[model samples]
Every structure is written in C-alpha cells, then in structure tokens.
Target: MIFFEDTVSVVKVAVSLLLALASWLLIRFPAPFRHYLNPRPALTLWVSFIGLRVIPFIIVYLIMDFAPRSDTEFFYKKAIAAFAGKMVYRDFLSYHGPLFGYLISLPLYLWYNAKILIPFMAIVEFAIVWATWRYYQSSRPDALLMAVLYFLLPMPFVAMILSSEEDIWFWGVGLITLAYASRAQGSLWIGIIWGLSMIVIKSMIIVLLVPLFFLVDNKFKYVLGLAIVGIPSIVILYLLMGDAFLMPLQHSGYNMTPNIVSITRPFLSGVYNQISLTRLNTISLCITMALSSWAAIRYRHLGYRQIFPSLYVLTFGIFMLAQPSAPGFYLFMYMIVVLYEMVKIEDRSFNVQLILLNFLIVIEPIIWVIYVGMLNYDDWHTVFSSGVNTADYLIQVVEVGLLLALVWRTFVHLRSLDRAASQSFAASSQRTGSSPVS
Candidate 1:
C-alpha cells in the first residue's frame, strides 16, 4: 500500500508489487540461468554479481529519494545547547552511529545539499562483496547469492537503500565478521573492527563475534587479539563522546530480553499484558549460550575450522530467543553461512537436515510478514506506513517460531558433534586397549 503512496492509482501498486516479487523470484532461484549463475568467464560473472547488488541499490535509492523523511532523522535541527560543536549521541534517539553520522555528513558538507548515505552505502556494499569473494573461493557462487540475500533481506539494507538512512555500518561489521572468520589467522585488528562495528550496529553484528571467539585456535592469541582491537576503540569512543559513548551499549543491553510473551499473548487471546519477563528471558538466554559455549569447547579438538558453523548456530540461536523482537534480520544473515555449509555437506543422511533447513530459509520471511501484521493490529492503519509492518499477531507467531527453530537446530547440531566425539574416543580406546586419558 505504501508503495503506491506516490501514485493515487491502485493499479500502479499491483503492478509494482508483481514486478518486485517476480524480480525476487528470479533473484532467489536463478536456476534456469545456470550459465549465468554458475562459473562463467571471469569478467561476465563479476559484472553479473555487481549488477545484482548495484541495480537493486539504485532502485531503492530512487524510491527513498522520492519519499519524504520522517522527523526522526532530523530531530535536533535547531542548534543544541548540549552539543555546541559536538555530535549528539542521545540514547536510542540518534538514528546513525556517531562515526557513521559524521562520515555521512562529511561529503555533504563539502559537495552540496545532497544525502551522503546512499553512495557511501553502495561503496561499502561493493567492498563487502569483493572481500567475501576473496575469502571464500570454494563458495564464491554462494557468496554472490549471499550478496543478493544480504541486500534483499537485512533490515540494515532497507534502512540504507530504501529509506536512505545511515545503517551501512551493519554490513561493514557483517563483512568483517565473515572475512575474519574465514581467514586462517586470527587478527586483533579485525576483532576490534568487528567489536566497534557491533557497538554501532549491535543487532546486526553482535552474535557473529561468538564464532570468532570460539574459532580462533590459540586462546591467548584470540583473547589478546580481540581485546587489543576492541578495548581501544571503546576507550576512544568514550573519550570522544563521554557518557554518550555508553548510550549505544546501554540501549543494546536494554533490549537483550526476548519479548516472546508480549508479542504472542494477544495472538493466543491470553490476558498476559507484559511479554515474558526480561529477567527470565535473560537467564534462559544465558543458559542456552553457556550450553552452546560448552558444545564449542567440547568439540574444539575437531579442529577450529569446523567450529565456525557451530559458532554461528549457537550465537544466532541464543540471540533470537534472548530478545523479544523479530529475529528475522539476524537469522537471515546467519542463514547465508548455514546454507553455505549445507551445500558443502556430501552426506546423504544430512539431506533430511538440508530439507528442514531449506524449508526454514524459504518460509521465514513470509511468516515474518504475517507475524508483524498480527502484533501491530492496533496500529493497523499504519501497517506498511513508513517501514514495512505486518499484522502484529502474525509477527508474534513467526518470531516465536523462528526463535524456537534456531534453538532446536543448535541443540541438534551440538548433539551431532557430541556423538561424533564419542565415536572417535571409543575408536581410539579400542586401538590402545587402555582407558583414554582426558
């Protein structure tokens, strides 16, 4: 409905949606275009992937430019007495991260009255694609698929491309996390880059760090590397913004609760007013996270490289249940990593697992749309207003389903690792004819 806001004709919206969905279908399942989808002449494939990310970005940019901005982006238009020559970092209020806002404005301050976000975002996206392609040679095909998936699915992409907002930093952290994880060596510099990126865009990159921590081979090197990268960036942020530097962190922690009860209560027609308690959610999340960590530690001997997928599962699973909000964005990004693994598996038995995983991948977005509509029924008039909102009740259900599905998968994956470990241990003991030393 909002897509037709610019035009009074209803037919236009129908046409636009049809075209968009058709484009999406082709993008998601470009099987008929296998020559294009598969490895081709290097130049042709590179151009095709670039076209995929850039063309959509351009389309969205045009739409956002045509649309009007809400007052939220320019909340402090007047000269603020509090921040005379400084940047604002009001808690939950500021739209962009401090660094992002400044960087976004730098070009505008120099070039003209135009927005700096779209072009800067396009550049950042291109870099992420380049880096991902460089890191995962075997999965370059999947990486191209991932690049499209990232833009199409992530909330940050919507904010950056469709709304012309400054959420480009989310992708920056996402790429960094993936790139660093894929690398054989552990680097402190990359860790700090990731940590700071999370500080700015917590929802997008926070859980990705879990994989890095668990996957690094040397514990001291891992901890030291991350601390060196993370600690200084934080300290600098504090020095530059003082209390405001803490604002983002505080806001992130505040929303740590999984709001499952609140969102789902009305759908069940239950009388419960508040969603499940944050404390309870937090405790459950902690327990789940601990179990995931144990699973990683237990299976560390399998080699650090194998643990990346497990780390992602554990990280994203815990996060989805930990927070009450839609896990769509985080789950979607992590699915890219998960799908890549699924394709790499040669075992036929894992086909059942593949089917289930693929089912979730396909249905999650559609379910989320319905769930959003249900949860926000009271605000029905504003459904799909400025941003996409579905029925509030439906959103509640999908959120719950997504959270549970991920957690269930994490436990299953952990158990698989445990079984594999036990078999390996038994075989070694049999060969030695002695009880194996721990």
Candidate 2:
C-alpha cells in the first residue's frame, strides 16, 4: 500500500502497537516487569511517556522530514485564516467547534511553527497522566501504571503525536470538572466552563454534560451552568455568526467508516451516496438522548464523580457509535476511564476486550486508507474499491464488537452500583426500624 510520505503512517502504526504491547505486558504481568524497574514507578511512567512521544517525534519530523498531515494542516490553515481577520463560520468553513481554530493556532502565534503542536500535545498528555495519578494514587496502587497504559493505548498515542487531535483536552476538562464537584467546591464557573467547552470543543461533549445533570450532586450548578453559560454563549454566537453558527444543527457532513452508514455500505451499495446526514443526525441524536436519559434515571442515587469512570465508557460509546462521523481519536479522550474501571474489575476478558479495541481502532484509518487509497470519498464503490475490502469489513466487525462489550460492561457496572445502593439502604432501614415507602 502507498502510505503517507512513503511509510510514515505504516511505521507510526507499528510504533503505536509496540508502545501498547510494552504497556500491556508491563501492566498485565507486573511481577516480572517490575523486577527491573520497581525502584521508582512514578519516575518510570513519566520517562516512558516523554520518551515514547519525543523519540518518534524526532524521527518523523527531523529524520524523515514528514510534515503535518490532513487534520493538523487543515487546522493550521483555518487558524491562519482566522488570524487574517476572517470570521470562522461566516467567512470560511469548519466542521469542528468555533474555538478549534484559535486554540490549535496558539503554537503559531508563539513559536511560529506548527511542529510545536507535537510537543504541546505531549505535555498535555503528561499533565493528564499526572492528574489521573494524583487523583487515584491514595486508593489505587498502580495509578500511574493505569495512566501509562492509557497513554500507550495505540489509537490515542497515534492521534495525539501523529495526527495532533485535541480531543484529549475534552477529558482534561472533564477531570477538572469532576475534581471540583467531587470535592463539593463546584462553582458557577464549573458549569460555565463545561457549558462553553461544549461549543469550544465538540458538540458531542454534551454527552458528558447531559449525564452530569442526572448524577451530579450539585444540580443547581449544572442547571445554571447550561442556562447561564449555555444561553448567552448561544445568543452571542448566533449574533456573531448569524445563521452560520448553527452549522452543527444542519448536519451537512457525510458519513464515515465504522458508523452505521459505513457498516451497511458493503451490502446496501445503493444507500452509499443516498445516505442522509439529516436522518442519521436525527437517529444519532435520538439514540444519544435515550441512552443519556436512561443512565440518568438509572443512576440518580449516585454522585457524578462516583460513576464518571464508567460513565465515560457508556456515554462515549454513544458518542462514537451513534454519531454520523465517528473518529477513533474520540477513544483517547476517555480510554483512561476504561482502563481504571477495568483495573477495578481485573477480569482477563475485559483485558482482552480493551486490547482488541485499541488494536482495531489504531489500525482503523490505515485499513480504510489502504482500501480506498485516499481519504476523500468519491462514490458508492469506495467500500469495494480495493482488494483489502473483505478484511476491512471483518476488522470493522471486531471493532464494533469490542465497543459493544464496553456497553455491556457499563450496564453491569451501573447495575452493581444500583444493587449496592439498594442493599445499603435496606441495611440502614433495618437498623433504624424503618421501611422504604414502596
């Protein structure tokens, strides 16, 4: 296959799996792995993340002379346009959030080079790891180990360092919000930040916020957050961009692979070009709302922070599968949550599921690229465009299967929490000589 820059993407895939394999072995078999590096696990994880990111960065940027591809380059152009005084939705075009352009362009404003984004994302990755370790260290023995596994989850590593996606920041913001609410110090600004982040980051972020409304102990904060922050932000954007700010509402984009559309493409060839984004958007939105509402009602007794780890998997499952365009980079945003929850479960089956999911996701783009030989979609023949077509469909099946496993596990998790809450309430009632009203 003709890969980007003659082997950059292929080699990057290999490197991603290497990092994942190394992390998998170390985490799965801690005894022998720790025998050599048990002196200071903290420092070891830091070095591992930094070293893994920096080394490939050097080889790709300096040695191979590889430049920013697709998304990264596209972001830079949008930022450049914005810097030149063109309005985002009104003057030009963007499928992402309003702030994506300005945010991605910060490197250009300071360093005047796009490559700074690589190291910038590396630093963000480290900071997220640090935050996870700091939060879980008191209770969990291998908090940093979980962070390391997340860092090397293959799709995330490739997305951050190679593709330069900013989706990880979504989780960063989530961790911050959860940290505050968990401590009972949540302020209006938390809501504002979360509310604004939905516009600034991605609309799919609302999946996280919607459940928080049901589960968070501080309903006033989220209620006012969406109201005080969400309304004014919308009015201002509408004022600024007029009808253009409502681009997301229009659902003008087409379907991509690994979605309901692409999944059906192999058989329903006629529906390929005829696929309706508006219809898909409607379906996706319906699915998201039903899932979010069900989760909220099911877990109303629990605190948001208490269930957020599994919440990430549950909500993002809808985010990934229900959406018209499901980018695998979305996994990096909450892979750590899945890792931490799986650590609590300690089930070998979950371990297999996590590994297989990451492996399939990491190669998802490569498989599509190999099959179509390009990123742009031209016609209905795209699915059967190349010889790798059959293998691609099988890979897509496994990918979907692994994601569905997460859905099942999340249901099991929420059910267990519900039972625990019920039992605890029953015990307390017996001690107090009282009974539930029902």
Query: By lDDT, who's the top model here?
Result: 2
* Model 2 C-alpha lDDT per residue in residues 19-107, reported as the tens digit of each score: 76876776677776456555677777767776778877887777877787757676677777767778878886676678777766676
What C-alpha RMSD separates each model from the true structure?
7.2, 3.4
Which candidate number has the best TM-score? 2
RMSD of 1: 7.2
Worst 10 residues of 1 by lDDT: 75-84
Instruction: Please list the C-alpha lDDT of all candidates, in the order they appear.
Output: 0.48, 0.71
Query: Could you tell me how far off, in angstroms, the CA of residue 370 lies in candidate 1 after the best superposition?
Result: 14
Stretches of model 2 off by over 4 angstroms after superposition: 1-6, 33-41, 182-190, 217-221, 248-252, 267-275, 344-346, 373-386, 423-438
Could you tell me every candidate's TM-score relative to the true structure? 0.63, 0.87
For 1-438, candidate 1 gives per-residue lDDT tens digits of 333333412332343344345434544465764455546434543564455445654554455454323221352231121233455465324533455444445444443333334555556655654555555656445455544433433333333433344333444455555556546554554565665665454424544555456555665666676677567766776786677655543433323112454444335423333444445445545655566567677676665445555566566666666554423444444544444443332333343333333333333343333323333332334444534454333444555565576567656766676687878898999898977665
